[model samples]
Every structure is written in structure tokens, then in C-alpha cells.
Target chain A: MKRSERLVDMTKYLMERPHTLISLPFFAQRYDAAKSSISEDLAILKHTLATNQDGILETVAGAAGGVRYIPYIGKGHAEEYLGDLASRIEDPNRILPGGFVYLSDVLSNSQDLQWIGRLIATRYAYSDIDVVMTVETKGISLAQSVARYLNVPFVTARKRSKVTEGATVSVNYISSSLDRVAKMELPTRALKKNSNVLVVDDFMKGGGTLTGMEELAREFDSTVAGICVLCEADFDKEKLVEDYLSLVKISKIDTQKRIILAEPGNFLTETDFSQL
Target chain B: MKRSERLVDMTKYLMERPHTLISLPFFAQRYDAAKSSISEDLAILKHTLATNQDGILETVAGAAGGVRYIPYIGKGHAEEYLGDLASRIEDPNRILPGGFVYLSDVLSNSQDLQWIGRLIATRYAYSDIDVVMTVETKGISLAQSVARYLNVPFVTARKRSKVTEGATVSVNYISSSLDRVAKMELPTRALKKNSNVLVVDDFMKGGGTLTGMEELAREFDSTVAGICVLCEADFDKEKLVEDYLSLVKISKIDTQKRIILAEPGNFLTETDFSQL
Candidate 1:
């Protein structure tokens, strides 16, 4: 294959399987090109990705060395995206009865999911997240998005039991919204023992659901790599969990006046985009 | 940017947004290259993709035209993937109590989801699918995977109501497993009227849940573009709905004998891959 053709195929191949190593010998054999030529092609691919500030092609130097694609984003890009997302989320039409905001529209959007996934993956790029975990229904999309970019499988903990799953590990956390203890369960075989899990969700009220996930992680003898939510209700909220990150913080939601206030959360300050 | 660098970025861009049109001028401007140069880059991409038989880079000609990246697999590729998937589903260990098979592992597997999503997307690539719909719990992952490849938003119909989603549209369908009438609901604002919806699910027995989604789609003045399931059980079975596609068909599951039978469904023979 020609250099141009090889570059295109190489890019597509690397992007599909992120965090995986592709040795120079393998690329040379696949393209029927010389090892030196394959190395040069990778250099071009890596440089182009860096120039765009969208990804990183890390080169490992050793006998078992190769290139690993890391999903990274520029600081300017992150700030601009989060700002726009927060503005869209500030719309009062999303405010529901009892102060809950409707965010299914944003959660369901493919483009939004891509950006959100890439950003979260960028933050935890080096964290070695073995699995992505989230409580069922709303958090499924967010968890799936992050899992896609990270090239990892995501498991959802269900609010109620379904016979389809053979055996489950259940945990209870206070449903702060309703002020009741709620139970969530995960299939016993869904997650491996001692895996590093990253917990994600769509919304965080009193952080009760997150607590449930944290406890569930403990039951499996797994460690919580991080906790992140798409939106956090900052105002009318006594938080149950701490040391978590939110992409957008909802400071206020006035159902009577149909007003909502939102801004970028601690994610902006906590994430080190300077590495890009 | 040089041709080498452009090829890499172009591939990444196209992969990120599958089944979406990208104008030549957009690529030309992004790469700071001429129209002819961008055309040459895309030609290289198309050729490489065709050679791999894994994707299709379709060129749209006219005043409002550029290129589209469609995720498709050749017939041979689909057969191989489904064959492997069927064998995995045939494992006796997957059999749960009461004829139910455990599929949460397969549903959560990113690699498995990628192939399944591509296969389903290829079958309905040309269908004017305005939205993708599925019921909550297990089906969310399947819906998200298909929606990702289709580049469309997917909304889940919930089995239970939450305070988050305000007004809703609920429908009833017989729960085959439970042998009772069951209800599922979607937020009123989740789906638009007159949409062409594609219903998808992880597993289908009586297909009561699929019917509920169909009725919900009808309430919104929408047409069912198609219905597809990841796995369909033919053992111990009678089906409630007909005229649907199944990627994998489970012919038998003997709990006492510790045996199972599975194979590719009618979907393989029914789909036409000639467009690629």
C-alpha cells in the first residue's frame, strides 16, 4: 500500500482500539512497508494528532513497545464545550416538578455524548480504568459514552431486580430526592474482582446514588478510580457524597419562576488539560 | 498539512461521526489544503477502507455534497462475527434459571457491541430512521450502540416512572416472562411526533417489551422503521410479534442436559449488503 493509504487505514485502526499497543513490525507487515517507513508514517500520524489537540499517540520504546492512542482534548476546546453545554443546560424549560430538571434530550444526543465521553476519557486517560459503572436508566448513556472512548466495557447497576441477570450484589443508598433508602444491584459476573472502576451518572442530587455505587464497588473488592456526574444540583441540596466531579453545576432551579442557573463545575479546574 | 497528516485526521474525524455527511470544503479548510488536495485525501481513504472491507466511504456528488463514512461489514465478515457470537451464546454456562440465558456480559462488551452495532446499522443505513427507541434496563446498551453508529439520539422507555421526567406516554404489553400485563412509559417530550423509529432490544422471547415500544411510537404519530433484537429465543417458545430481525437465534437451552443451540438468524439472509 502507498503511504497515504497506509496513513488512513492506520488512523482508523488505532482510533478503533484505543489504549492498545500496535508494534512497528505489525504495521510494517500489514502495509508491506519497511520498518523505517512504518515508523515515519507513525510519526506523521502522531504529529497530526498533536497539532489538532484532539488525541495523543504515545510511543513506547522497548522490545514490546508500540503506539497507544490516548483521547485528549485541548484546554480551549474543553472550556468552550463546557461553556456551551452549561448554557444549554441553564434553560428553565428543563426544570421539572419538585425541582428536578429534565435532561433526557441532552443525554440522548450522540454529538453531546461524544464530546462528554472524550472529555471524561481525557481526564482519566492514565488512570487505567478497568470498568465503567453507573446506576441504571439515566446514567447508562453517560457511562456508555465514557466507556466507548476508554475502550472498556460498562456495567449498569439496576434499581430493581430482573431475572435475566443470574446473581447480583445489592447495595442500599439513601434516595435523597425521596428521602428513602433505595437499593441498587449489579450482576455478580458483570464486573471482575479487584477491578478499578470509574463511576459516572447523569445527575447528582444529594449524591445518594453515587454512594450506592461506591458501596457496591466495595462489595466487589474493587477500588473507585473516580466519580463524575453530568449535572449536579448545587442549590437545594445537602450532598451525601463528596470528592466527586461534575461537568456542569446547577446552582439554582426555581420551578415557580421557571428559572435555572448553571455554570461549569470543578471538572474544569480539576482536569489537567495542559498535558495536551 | 501534508497528505500523510491529512489522511490521519480525516480518518479520525470520519470515524468519530459515522453516517454523517462532511463537505469537501470543510476538510479542505480544516487541513488548510485545496479542494483537489482534499479530494485526493478522501480518495485514498475510500480506497483503503474498501480494501479492508470493514467500512464504506461514500461520496455524495452535487452542489451540496462531500463524503460520508458508513460503518459496514462485508457478508463474509458478518457471517464470521455472528458465527462467533452464536457459539458464545451456545455456552451452557450462559443458561440461567427458568430458560433465561445470561447476556449482560455480551451486552456490556465494547468489542461485541461494536460488531453488533455495525451489523444493525448496515441493515438500516438507508432507512429514514428518525429515532432509535428501546425499553430501559438491558436494552439501553443495545439502543445506545445502534444510536452511536446511526449518529442519532436514542430515548429509553422506562418501566417505572421517575420524578425527573415530567409528563409521559405509557403503554401496556403482556410480559411474557411474568405471564402478566406490563406497562412501560417514555417521557412525553422524549420523542418527537411523526418520527420514523427503529426499535431494538437485547433479548426477545415473547417480544412484549418490543410491542410496548411500538405502541409508544404509534402514540407519537411515528412509524416503525424496523425492529431488531440482539438475541431471539426459539426454544420453549411461541412469539407474540412477528416480522422482526434477529441477529442470533437460540434454538434450544436444556438446563438439565447442560446444552444449548444457537445460530445466525434470518437477519443474515434478509439483509442486502449490495449497497456497499
Candidate 2:
């Protein structure tokens, strides 16, 4: 193939498989080009991605080395996106009964998920995460999106067991929203032992669900690489867990007055974009 | 930017926003290149995608001219993937109590979702779908995957209402798996009226869940563009719904004998790849 054609295919290929290595010889064989020419094509791809500040093409040296695409969003892009997202969350229409904010619209948006997924993946690009974990229903989309960018499988823990999942491991945690103890479980075979897991969710209130996930990870002898939520209710005085991140923080919500206040969360400060 | 760099960026940009039209001038301005140069770059992208039979760069001409990236998979690729997927489903270890097949592993796989999403997107690339809808729990990931490729938002219909969703519109259907009447609901504001919705799910026995989703779509005054499931239990004698597509068909599962049988469904024969 010609250089131009190769560049287009190469970009698509690398973007689809983020955090995956592609050796130079493999590219040369696929394109029927010389190794030096393949290197040149990769250089153009690397430079183009850098110029756009959307991704990074890391080159590993030596015989077993190759180029790996990292879905790294620039700090400016992150700030702008989060700012817009926070403002969107500020709309009073989002305030629901009992101080709950309706975020189904934003959570369902593909474009929003793409940006959020890339932002979270960028933060853990080098975290060597083995898998992504989230609870059922609302958290599934967030987990899937982050897993896509990280190029890893995601496991969803369910509140109830189904026959389709076979045997499972269950955990109980306080449901702050309902002020009751809630039970959740995961398929026994869904996650492997000693795996590094990244826990994600759509919303966080008392962080009880996150604590439950941490406990579940312990049952499997796994490590919690990180915990992140798309939104956090900052006004909730009590929390069951610490050492977590949130993309947007909801500081206040007046149910009677229909008022809401939101801003970008600690994710902006906690993530080191400079690592790219 | 040079044509080589432009090609890489253009490919990435178009792939990111599938089914959305981008005008020639938009790319020209983004890359600081001439209109003619941008056209040449799009042509190269179109050719490369076509040669690979993975995507379609559709050109719309006239005063409002632009290009759209359709995530279309060739028949060969579809056959290969579904064949392999069916073979994987044939493992006796996947069989659980009551003849239920364990598919959480496959469903949680990111690479598998990518292929499944692209395949489903290919089938509905030109179906003018306004939104993708599925029930809560397992189907959320499938819905999100197809929604991402279709460039549309996906709404999950919950089996039980939650305070976070606010007002909900519900429907009652007979759950064939449990042989009992069941109810499912979607938030009132989650779906728009008169939308063309594509219904998807992880598995189908009597397709009761899919029927409920169709009814829920009807409640919103939306039309059902199509219905698809990742797997269908063909051994089940009766079905509540028809006019649907399945990627894999499970013919039999003998728990005592430790045997299972599976094969690709009607999707391969039903989808018209010639449109690309």
C-alpha cells in the first residue's frame, strides 16, 4: 500500500486498539513496505497525534518493542469538557425529588461517554489495570466506556443473581440513599484472582457502593487500582470511603426551590496529564 | 498540515463521529488545507476503508454536500466472527443449571463488544434509527455498544423504578423464563416521542423482555425500527415475538450430559451488505 493509504489504515487500527502494542515488522509485513518506511509512517502518525494532543504513540525500543497508542486527552481539553459538563449539570431542571439530580440524559449520550471514557483512561494509562468493575444498571455504561479506551474487559456486579451467571460471590453494604443494608454480588468466574481492578460508577453519594466493591475485590485477593465516579453529591456530609475521584461535583440541590449547583471535581487536580 | 498527516487526522475524526455528516470546508479549515486537498484526503480514506471492507465513507453531494462514516462490516468478516463466537458458545462449561448458558464473560469482553457493535451497526446503518433501547442489567452494555457506533444515545428501561429516574412509563409482559407476568419501565424523559428505536438485548428465550421494550417504545409514541439479541434459545418451543435478529442461536443445552450446541443466526443472511 501507498504511504497515504497506510497512514489512514494505521491510524484507524491504532485508535481502535488503544494501549496495545504493534511491532514494526508486523506493520511492514501488513503494508508490504520496508521496515525503514514503516518507521517513517509511524513517525508521521506519532507526530500527528502529538500535534492534535488527543493521543500518544509510545515507542518501545528493542526486538520485542513496538508502538502503543495511549488515549491521552490534553489538559486543556479535559478542563474545557469538564467545565461544559459542569455547567450542563447546573441546570435546575436536573434537580429531582429528595435532592437527586437526573443525569440519565448525559449518561446516555455517546459523545459524552466518549469524552468521559478517554479522560478516565488517560488518568490510568500507565496504571496496568487488569480489569474494570462497576455495579449493575447505571454504572454499566460508564464501565463499558472506560474499558473500551483502556482495551480491557469490564465486569458488572449485580444486586441480584440470575441463572445465566451460574455461581456468584455476594457482598453487603449500606445503601445510604435508602438507609438500608443492600446486597450485591458478582459472578464467581467474572474476575480473576490477584487482578488489578478500576472501579467506576455513574454517581456517588455516601460512597457505600464503592466500599462494597473494595470489599469484593478483597474477596478475590485483587487490588483496587482506583475508584472514580461520573458525579458526586458533595453535600452529603458522610461518606463510607475515601481516596476516590469524581468528574463533576454537585455541591447543592434545593428540591423545593428547584436549584442546583455543580462544578468540576477533584479528577482534574488528581490526574497527572503531564505523565503523557 | 501535509496530506499524510491530514489523512491520519481525518480518518480518526470521521471514525469518532460515525453517521454524522462533516462538510468539506470543515476539514479543510481544521487542517489548514485547501478544499481540493481535503477532498483528496477523504478519497484516500474512503478507498482504504472500502478496500478493507470495514467501513463506508458515504458522499452526499449538492449544495449541502458532506461525508458520513458508516460502520459497515463485510459479509466475510461477519461470518468469520459469528462462526468463532458460536464455536466459543459450544463449550459445555458454559452450561449452567436449568440449561441456562453463562455468557457474562463474553458480554463483558470489550473486543467482543466492538465486533458485535460493528456487526449490529452494519445491519442498521441505513435504518434511520433515532435511538437505541434495552432493558436494565445485562442488556445495558449491548445497548451502549450499538448506540456508540450509531452515534445516538441509549436509554435503559429499568425492571424496577428508582428515585434517580423520577417519573417512569411502564409496561407489563409475561416473563417466559420465569413463566410469570413481569413489568418493566423507562423514565418519562428518557426517550423522545416519535423516535425510531432499535431494540437490543443480551439473550432471548421467549423474547418477553424485547416485547416489553417494544411496548415501552410504543408508550412514548416511538416506532420500533428493529429488534436484535446477542443470543436466542432456539430450543424453546414457543416465542412471544418475531421479526427479530439474533447473532448466535443456541440449539440445545443438556445439563446432565454436559453438552451444548450453537451456530450463527439469521443476521448474516438477513443483513444486506451490498448497500455499502
Candidate 3:
């Protein structure tokens, strides 16, 4: 193939398999080009991605070395997206009966999921996250998206038991919203022992649900690499957990006046963006 | 930017937003280049994607002309992937209790999900699907993957209610696996009435779950564009629904003997590859 053709295919190929290494010889063989030419094509891809600031192409040296694309958004890009997302969350119409904000639309949106997933993945890019764990229903999609970029398995912790999953490990945590304790479980085979897990969820009020996931991670003898949520209800009376990241922080919600106050969360502060 | 750089950025931009139209003048202005130059760049992208049989760069000519990146996998690609997937599913270790096959690993693999989603999306690429629906738990990830490529919202029908979702519309169906009636619900605001929905699930036995999703979509005044599943147990005496596509079909399973049989599903025969 011609150099131009190789560049096009190489760009698509690298983008599709982020954080995956592709050796020079493999690209040369695939494109039927010289190793030197393949190297030059990769240089162009690396330079293009660097210029965009939305990704990074890390080059590993030596025989077993290759390029790995890292999905990353520049600090400026992260700030702008989070700002816009926070403003969107400020819509009072989203406030539910129990002080919970409806986020189904945002959670289901492909574009929003892509950005959220990329941001979360960027934060834990080098954390050795073997699996992405989240509770049932709401957090499933969030965990799936982050797992996609990280190229890891995502295990959902269910609130109820089903025969489909044979064996499980269960745990209980205070459901602050309901003012009662609730149980969550994960299939025994879903996660392996000693794996590094990153817990994620859609919302965090008192963070009871997240704590349950943390406990479940411990059940499998796994370590909690990090915890992140799309939204955090900062108006909550008290929090059950600390040292977690929230992408969008809801500072206040006025039920009677139908007012909501929100801003970018402390996620950025906790994330090391310098890796990009 | 140079024409080469423009093509690279344009491909990534269009791929990110599938099923959406962009006018030629928008790109022409974005690149500060002539409309003709922009047209040439799109042609390159179109030809590259076409040659790969992985995507379709649709050109909308005339007054409101632009391109669309249609996520598609050719028959050959689909066949190869399903064949490989079937062989992998044949592993005895995957055989769970009650003749169920464990598929969390495949469902959680991003590369596998991408191929499966693209293949399924290819069949329904032009089906006018407004939304994708699936039951809660395992089906959520598959729904999200397909929805992401189709650029549509996915709604999950839950087996149990949660306080997070304010109100819901529910339906009842016979759970053939359990030989009992079960109820499933979707949030009232999750889907719109009269929309076209594509129902998907990870596994199908009697397809009772899919029927429930179909009924739920009807309650929302939506039409079932189609139904598809990642795996369907062929040995499961009777099927409750028809006209559904299965990516892989498991013909038999013996837990005691540690034997299982699997093959490419009906998806290969049902999909048209000429679009490539």
C-alpha cells in the first residue's frame, strides 16, 4: 500500500485499539511497506494525536516495543466539558421526589458517555484496573464505558439475586436515601481474586452504594484502585465515604424554589492530568 | 491545515458522530479550504472505509450535502467473528448450572463488544431505529454498545424498582426459564412514544425476556424495529418469539459431561453484505 493509504489505515487502527501496542514490523507487514516507512507513518500519527490533545501515542523502544494510544483530554478540554455538564445538571426539572436528580438522559447519551468514559479512563489510565465494578441499573452503563477505554471487564453488583448467576458474595450497606440498610451482591466468578478494581457509579449522595461496591471488591480479595461518580449530591446531610472523585458536584438544591446549584467536581483535582 | 491533516481529523470527527449529517460548507469553513478540497478529503475517507468493509461513508449530495459514517461489518467479517466467538463459547468452563453458559467475559471485552455491536448495528443500520432497549443487568452493556454505534439512546427495563427512577411504565410476560410470569418496567421518561426501538439481550432461551421488552416498548407507543441477542440456546424446547437474530447459537450443552456445541447464528444469513 502507498504511504498515504497506510497513514489512513494506521490512524483508524490505532484509534480503535487504544493503549494497545502495535510493533513496527507488524505494521510494515500489514502495509507491505519498509520498516523505516512504517516508523515514519507512526510518527505522523503520534504527532497528529499530540497536536489534538484528545489522545496520546506513547512509543516504547526496543524489539518488543510499539505504540500505545491513550485516550486523554487536555486540562482545558476537561474543564470546558465539565463546566457545560455541570450547567446542564443545574436544571431543576431533574430533581426527583427523594432529592435524587434524574440523569437517565445524560447517562444514556452516547456522546456524553464517550466523554465521561474517556475522562474517567484518563484519570485511571495507569492504575492497573483489572475490572470496572458498579452496582445494578444506574451504574452499569458508567462502568461499561470506563471499562471500554481501559479495555477491562466490568462486573455489575446486583441489588437482588437471580438464578442466572450461580454463586455470589453479598454485602450490606446503609441506603441513606431510603434511611435503611440494603444488600448488594456480585457473582463469584465475575471477578477474580487479587484483581485491581475501579468502582464507578452514576450518582453519589451519602455514597452508601459506592461503599457497598468497595466492600464487594474486598470480598473478592481485590484492591480498590479508585472510586468515581458522574454526579455527587453535595447537599446531602452527611457522606459515608471519603477519598472519591465526582465529575459534577451539586452544591445545593432548593426544592421549594426549584433552584439547583452545580459546578465541576473535585475529580480534576484528584486526577493527575500531567500523564498526558 | 493540510489536506492530509484535514482528512485525519475529519474521519475521527465523523466517526464520533454517526447517523448525523454535516454540511459540506461547515467542513470547508472549518478547514479554510475550498469546497472542492473538502470534497476530495471526504472521498478519500469514503474510499478507505469502503475498502475495509468495516464502515460506510455515505455522501449526501445536492443542496445539503455531507457524509455519514455508517458502522457496518461485511458478511465475511461477521462470519469470521461469529465463528471465532462460537468456538470460544464451546469451552466447557463456560457451562454454568441449569445449562446456562457464562458470557460475562465476552460481553465485557471491549474488542468483542465492538465487533458484536458493529455486526448487529450493520443489520439494523438502515432500519430507522430511534432507540435500543434491553432488560436490566447483563443486557445493559450490549444495549449501550449498539446504541453508541447507532448514535441512539438505550433504555433498560428493570426487573425490580428503585427509588432513583421516579415513575415507570411496566409490562408482564411469562418467564419461560422459570415457567412463571414476571414483570419488567422502564422509567416513564426513558423513552418517547411512537419511536422505533431495537430490542437486544445477551442470551435468549424461550425469549420471554425479549417479549417483555417488546410489550414494554408497545406500552410506550413505540414499534419494535427488531430483536437480537448475543447467544440463543437452540436446545431450549420452545421459543416464545420469532424473527430475532442471534450472533451465536448453542445447539447443545452437557454440564456433567463437560460438553457444549456452538455455531454462527442466524445473523450471518439475515444480514446483507453488499453495502460494503
Task: Place model 3 in a CAPRI quality band.
Answer: medium
Residue-wise C-alpha lDDT for candidate 2, range A1-276, written one tens digit per residue? 999999989999999899999999999999999999999999999899888889999999999999999999999999999999999999998888888889999889999999999999999999999999999878888999999999999999888888888889999998888889999999999999999999999999999899889989998999999999999999996989989999999999888888899999999999989954
Order of the predicted models by lDDT, top scorer first? 2, 1, 3
What TM-score number comes out for model 1?
0.98
lDDT of each: 0.90, 0.93, 0.88
lDDT of 1 by residue, B58-107 (tens): 99999799999998888889999999999999999998999999998888
Q: Which candidate gets the maximum lDDT versus the true structure?
A: 2
Name the better of 1 and 3 by TM-score. 1
Q: For candidate 1, what is the DockQ-based docking class?
A: high
**Residue A38, candidate 1: how far off, in angstroms?**
1.1
Task: Report per-candidate DockQ.
Answer: 0.86, 0.91, 0.67
lDDT by residue for model 3 over A19-119, one digit each (tens)? 78889888988888899988777777766766777888889999899888888888888999999999998998888876778899999999999999999
TM-score, model 3 to reference: 0.97
- The residue-by-residue lDDT of candidate 1 on A1-276, one tens digit each, is 899888888888888888888898999999899999988998998899889899999999999999998889998889999999999998988988888888999888889998999999999999999999998888988998899889999999998888888899998989888799989999899999999999999999899899999999999999999999999988855788888999999998888889999999999999988777
Best by the TM-score measure: 2
- Position B246, candidate 1: lDDT: 97
Question: Model 2's lDDT to the true fold?
Answer: 0.93
Q: Taking the candidates one at a time, how many backbone clashes does each contain?
A: 0, 0, 0
